[model samples]
Target: MALLEVDHLSVTYTPRDQPANRAVHDVSFHLSEGEFVGLLGESGCGKSTLGNAVLRLLSPPAHITGGRVAFDGVDLTEADDEQLRKLRWVDLSTVFQSSMNSLNPVIRVQAQFADTFAAHKVPGDVTERATELLELVALDRRVLRAYPHELSGGMKQRVALALALALRPKLVLLDEPTTGLDVVVQRGILTRLAELRRELGFAVLFISHDLGTVLEMADRVMVMYGGEIVEDRPAAEMLREPRHPYTRGLLGSYADPRLPDVRVSYIPGRPPDLSRTHAGCLFTTRCPHAEDPCRTIHPDLLPDRGGLVRCLVAQENRLPVVTLGSAEAATVLGSHFPATGSLDRPADAADAAPVLTVERVSKRYTSRRGMRTNTVEAVRDASFALRPGRVTALVGQSGSGKSTLARLVTGVERPSSGEVRFTGEGGADVRVDRLRGRALRDYRRHVQMVFQDPFSALNPTRTIAYALSRPLANFAGLRGAAARERTAQLLESVGLSPAGQFLDKLPHQLSGGQRQRVVTARALAPEPRVLIADEPISMLDVSIRAEILELLGDLVRERRLAMLYITHDLLSARLLADEVLVLNQGTLVERGATREVIGSARDDYTRLLLDSIPNPFGKAAGQQTLPST
Candidate 1:
């Protein structure tokens, strides 16, 4: 028997006075012993819902409406609450996305393992089991005495993994386990998990939004769209010949920074609304190959050459299956950039009059640790410039001081040493630290920022119109009807057309892409001369990412605005930046044109960052290339 089998499983969330939303619709799949299956999709495509349903962890308003989830022949849907509780952590377990928040903050790491063991009524020494599991994930026993806050993000995630395997469960479900981590950290976690899986012989269901990571770890790949599994195939086959249009779009949406001069594309429209019932294919709205049959008749999982696909066009052989490396893929490359020649490089922006300059800036923070105080150098002698109509990208790993430098540029924090200067009105160089009262306000109005998380950056309780109007009122002195009108105009500029439709909607009501667009619109409200975007699109979906990148490029070119595009992903830097600055350990290691630095790196640290990217077309799990940098 299969280790885990989900047969025609359906989950629905029924909100009060609203329509019932079928998040997971008739999804059927099975995991054999020790098999690794990757479930991938966009944010709202129900990847998490499916995983939750399998674990029998669905809360109120999110209950299984149909089908069965059988683990080793015992149906989870029919199991009692007490029975299900017993099965978890012993027979089945899960590692959630946010490891830091998932653990109890008030207790040490060791106590958490003891609580799990006590709850499951397992017969073993909790300390011994915890220590063994920690070693399994390559963590030291010293971590047991530390609190969650003391551990790094990667270390916390490893602790969570160790807890999940405390009882040697037959299967484990990982839901976006590596999200928000740096590439190097993400690679380490995945590598360790793969090794443990082989040694322990447990089936894994890895659900993630990152296609490249999924492609790297999964033995078999499944693409979920609008609550349905549209494609299922072996990992190698799926990467080679993706049959469904949605799968093809996902594979082409992201630009791999490690690969030089590669073209990226995105799906045209948004995903379908699950609250409303659809009689046809769930992806018809965004599928480029949708036809009459796709609009009226829903397709079923039909057998193909090496896997199963749920598309009428595929069954009819209307659209040819294209491989990622095929010649015909050039048409699907989407953008109008040249296919062969080297990508455009930024002009000598270093020689131009800089709009904003950071000269030998360094910031130090003194923190109290127990009885002693320690000084941390967040940024050290960092120097860079943002020139007119040019994008200067700041690339670095997490804790490499990219964010500290951003704060220094935006005047949120003062540098302990060195200077931050910007070209003020009337073309005079002004020191940012010396600005006072109204001068400081005016300085802030001209130097705006687009933060990383759009949801947190925006006010959740307030209307979209209110969020945009605040900046206009405070920065431009616009109020009442005038501010409202400008808000509508700003919304239209960001591609959220018919601004009236979204004016009164809350931030939570909008999609990830739309929320990010609103964030971009708010930053542009002041018509700032210099815009600093800190990882603006990293949290967004792959299909939504290209739109944001293209929007930034358009704004910079059309408005002739100087931009400091801060991101850890080199692919995004390559696509949006003119100049690239590499930061490592609070110091600037390399700075040059984006194409030149990425295409031919002279520094080992710079090369390490490039080599760390997970290649979708590369070898399978445990075979990924690694670098210590």
Candidate 2:
């Protein structure tokens, strides 16, 4: 018997003010014993809703309207509350999308495990079982005594995985388990899960927006769009010859780091609104190959070659190649997008003048725990100069002093021993630490920062207008109608058109892309000469990323602003930066023109970082493929 099966599943949400939203429309799939299946799609495509429906965890305004979910010959939809209570952890379990924050902060790791055991009524020594599970996930036993905050992000996720597998369930549902994690840590977690599945023989239903990781980890892949499954096939076959246009578009969204200088493309239009019904295909608006019938007839999943696809054009073998050409993408990126060949090397600019300069700066932190005192060097004699109309990228892994350096430059913290100096067009150089009163205020006005995680950076309760106007009122001394006029202009500059529409809306009302744009607009409100953006696009979706990068590059060139782009992804650094500075363990290891440093690196650490990026394309020669479960 199949381990899990869903036949004609459907879900809908009925909000009080708005019309009913049909999230999942007649979605159907199955997972066999010991099989690893991947569910791939973009955000708001009902991937998480389907997963939640299968687990019977959907809360109101959302509910499963119709479906038959059978697990091991038992219909879960018809199961009683008592039966569900017994079946939950014993036969089925789930690891959620944000499992890193799932643990209770007040409890120790082992105590949380004990609670799980008590609820499930599992018979065993709780402490020993916890230790064994930790070992299975490649974590040390010491983590059992620590709180959730004490553990790193990856460690917390591993703990969640261990907890889910505590009862040795027959099947596991994993939803976006590795999203937002570093590539190296993501690979490690997936590898560990694969090993455990092989040893324990449990089926898996993995849901993610990350296609590259899915291609590497899953045996079979299913593509979802507008709450419906569009294509289903073996992982290799799907990547090699994807029939559905939606599938191909997703594949093109990610750029393979192995193929340096490659241009990636994304679907342009927004997803369909679920509250309003569609007559034809849900993806027709963004489909490059969309035609006559696609506008009037809704396609159904039918056999095409060896797999099943829902596109009429695919069944007739008329779909064009989805891989976009460089010139085509460039035109789509618009003529105004900065070209690599058009700009001079930032370090060699003829009119270069230092906006901010750091000279032999170092910072150290001293911490005392119990009876031991330890001193850690965050930055070790790092020196660099920021020139106007230039972008210099500081590339490093986490804990390599990237954030520390940013704080030093932003005046959040002073260096322990060295000097940070700033010079204007004709003004004498001013030491940062010596500034006070009006001098300090003036310096802050000229220097501003755009932070990572735009969602957290903005106040959720405040309107967008309030957030943007604060800096203008405090620094530029504009208020009331004057401040409002400038706010609208700032919003327009960042590509958020019709500023009046967004001014009154709260931060939560806007999309991720729009929220980041508002954050960028807020930073630009003070007319700062220097902007420090730290991993600004890391949390955004693939399609929205290029737009934000283009916006930043345009602002830098048009305003003659000095930009410090801090990131761990070398691909992005190469795309936006003219100069690259490589840092490792608080020390500057390499610095040169962007192309030279990326193409021919002398440092082994830099090479390792470049190589660690996940290749979304097919496997390279001598690459180790994960063994199928």
Candidate 3:
């Protein structure tokens, strides 16, 4: 018998003034004991909603309209408050998308764990249990004394994971558990989770937008689209032969950085709006092979090749198997979406003068605790040059000084030693470190940064127009109608077309991808010669990532701006960067052409980062063959 069964589940979000939106429509799935099943899809595709619904975690404005969530033979939808209280942590637990949000900021880590144990009336020494749990996630027991703010992102996630497993629940639901983590840290968390599962024998319902991670970890994979389960199959089978076109498109989107050459592509167009009912196939708009009948008749999920698939073409056994990046793949998979730019090293880039130069730059921080002074080196003698029309990728692990370098370059931090120089107007070398007041303000006009989190990077109280216009007025001395016109042009340049439509919209009104574009447009408002983008697309969906990467590349080529691309994703680096700089422990470990550095990495740290990347086609996939349709 299945450990958990979700039958005809439907979740709806009904606002008082707006129409009802069915986030999860008739979704059904089953997970056996000790099995790992992954729910994969783009953002807003209802994967997270379905996961939450199964646990009865949805609150006001969102409710499970219909469906039976049967866990261990108990119908969760019918469970009373008392029953749910006992079931939640004892039989089932969840790790949310953001660990910081899930953890209480005011409470110490030890107290938090103790509260859970005491609330459940577990008979044991809470501290001992907490220590064991932390150890299980590869964390030190001393972390118990620290607050959630004191821990790193990866550590917080591990703590959350430990809390979820405290009661030895039969099933655990992980919602985008490893999202936004560095590859090395992500791999470590996943590895530790796998080991814990093996030891405790708990089932996991892993939900994520990353296709590669799901394919690499999950035993069975279910592809979700338009609030429904479009396809469900073994991970290995899905990796080799995805029956649904949407599933195939997702597979094609992933490009292994270790490869000699890769051609990554995304399905054109965005997902369907769940606010309105659809008569035809949900994915028909995005599928390249969509036919006339697909426009009117909604396809049913039918058995196909040992799994269920909702596609008319696949049901008819007419869909061809084409290797990604081949001529046939382009023809069948709709390569109409422009390429993810190119990695072609520019001939003039080598001869171009340096726009910004860092000479023996180092950053240090001193913190005193209990009359003891400790100094830590964040960046150590880093030297590099940003040339016009070229992208130099700074790749490193989380605490390896990637962001510190960005701060030093953008003049946010003063280097303890050495200096940062930028070529000013009339070939004047400006020392970024000594700039004061007006000079500093003017220097900022020539350098701008696009932060990682677009939502936080933007002011929530402000409209898109205000966000862009402020920079225009401050840096370009444009206001009124001129500022408005320039804002539209910047929006259009970032691929948010019909810029007038987005001008009045608030940051909350736009999607993740759209918000990132707005953030990019605001950065370009100053018309800077150098662009520093720190993990620009790391928070976006895979499909949207291709779009953002393409936009960044186009901007660099069209404007001939020098760019510093800081990221932990090697695959994205391979897709966008011309040159690569590997940082390990605040030290430059490797620097070379993108292809050369990734294809033939010499530094141990560089090789580790590349190896940590989730490879769906690696040995873990095993020997599998695509069945003849």
Candidate 4:
């Protein structure tokens, strides 16, 4: 018998004075006892809605319009409040996307555990139970004394997981559990979760947008699209032969850095708006092999290759085999670069001089608590050069000083020792740290930065035109009609076409990918010689991530701009960077060509980063389990 089952589930959100948005449409699935079922999809595809609806956790504005959520033979949709209260936490629980926000900020971890036990009237010693829970997640008991704010992101996530499993629930629903965590930390959390699942024998409904992670940890994978389940199959089979095009696209978007050749592509176009009704296939607009019937006839989920797939082409066994590096993929990606080839520097790039140089730079911070002063080194004697038309990737885990190094290079913070030099007019070496007022402004004109979070980087109240035009006017000395024209061109360069349409739209009006393009456009408005992209695509969807990477690569090649690509994602580093530098605790651990370093890493830290990457292909694809650190 199944542990959980959803029959024809549908969820809708109807805001006051707004049309009903059907977020989850006729979704159905089943989870067996101890089974790890992954729900995969892009953002806004109803993965979370389905998970919440299953547990009857949806609040106002969202309601389960129709469905039967059967958990352990109990119909959750028909259950009363009292019945739900008795079942929740004891039979089922959840770990939300943001662990920090999920936890009470003012409450100590110990108190939070006590509250759960007290509310449930569970007969047990709170301290002893809490200690046992913490140990299960590999966290120390001392964490019980700390508040939510005192713990790190990974620790908070683990705490949330511990809370979810406190009562030894039969099933747990985890939504994007490791989304924002660093690779190593994410791997540790997942490994620990897998170990606990084995020991406790609890079923999991893991909902996430990350295809690689889902494929790595899931026993069975269900791909969601357009508020519906498009594919449901075993993880290994789905990885080997995905029947649905959307599933294939998601898989193709991930590239293994350890491979000799790495290529990644994305599906074109955005997801359909759920508020509006659709007649045909929701993915038709983005589907490469979309046909006539696909435009008007909606497909139903039918058995295909031992799994359910919602596609006419797959039903007819007529789906084309399009490789990631094929022409069809290139057309779908809209990429200007070659489908498969060496990401070598252009022939003319060899003789270009260094645009920026860091000479044994170091950064330190001193914080005083009461009468005691403590000093910490954020970066130590780091040396590198950014040459024109070349991308120098700085790869490291969080708190490894990657961002601090970016700040030091862009003159945000002065180095405690040594110097940062930029090539100025007439071949002069300008000392970045020594620059003042006007000189500082001039230096900023040559060096521009694209921040990590596009949503936060952009101004909420300002229009796209204002964001781009201000930079143009200030740095390029352009005004009036000239600034407007320049802004349009900037948008076009970043691939946000029909610039007039986006010009008047606010940041919130654009999709994450569009907002990032606008951010990139604003960065290029200054016509900077050097571009520092600090985890620019970390917050974007997998498909959009490929687009941003391709855009950055195109800009570097065409404009001969030197780029510093700082990120924890080694696969992206492999895809875009010509050279790679590994950082460990602010220290330079390894440096070499991208392929050589990632494929045959020397440093333990570098290898650890590579190992942390989720391998969808599993053991057959040479993926080894991440070692315990």
lDDT, candidate 3, 238-344, per-residue tens: 76677898887886666567666566777667799899888999998888789999999999999998899999989999887754433233223435444553454
- Which parts of model 1 have CA positions greater than 4 angstroms off? 122-125, 258-260, 325-350, 369-371, 620-629
Candidate 1 C-alpha lDDT tens digits along 1-629: 88898999999999888899989999999899889899999998999999988988789899899999999888899999888887888888999897557999889999998898888787777778899989999999999999999988989999999999988998999999989888778878888888788888898999998877787778899999999999999987877777888787776764455455556677767788899978889888877778988898999988887899999998888776465544334335443221221144333445678889999999999999899999999999988888877889999999999999988888888899999999988999899966778878788988999989997998889999999999998888999999999999999988899999999999989998899999999999999999999999989997778778878887787777889988888877888888899999899999998888998989998887887776665542224443211
Q: Provide the overall lDDT of each model, using Cα atoms, as 2-decimal numbers.
A: 0.84, 0.82, 0.86, 0.86
In candidate 4 the C-alpha lDDT for residue 628 amounts to: 17
Q: What residue runs in model 2 are displaced by over 4 Å at the alpha carbon?
A: 258-260, 322-351, 369-371, 498-501, 618-622, 625-629
lDDT of 4 by residue, 1-629 (tens): 89999999999999999899999999888899999999999999999989889889899899999878999999999999999998899999999878657799998999999999999987878999999999999999999999998998999999999999999999999999998899999999999998888888999999999988887788899999989999999876776667888887777676667767677777768899999989899999988778999989999998888889999988998986433433233233323222332354342354468999999989999999999999999998999999888899999999999999998888878999989999987999899988888888889989999888999999899999988888888887898899889898999898889888998899988989999999989999888999999999999988678778888888898898899999999988998888899999999999988889998999999999998887664432544653211
lDDT of 2 at 562: 91
Residue 346 CA displacement from its true place in model 2, Å: 9.8
Enumerate residue pairs that collide in model 2: none
Provide the lowest-lDDT 10-residue window in model 1.
333-342
For candidate 4, what is the lDDT? 0.86
| Alpha-carbon deviation at 533 in model 1, angstroms | 0.7
Clashing pairs in 3: none
| Model 2 per-residue lDDT tens digits across residues 347-372 | 33825878899999999999999999
**Model 1: residue 69 alpha-carbon error in angstroms:** 0.8
How far residue 24's Cα lies from its native spot in candidate 3, in Å, is: 0.9
Question: Residue 173 in candidate 3 has what lDDT?
Answer: 94
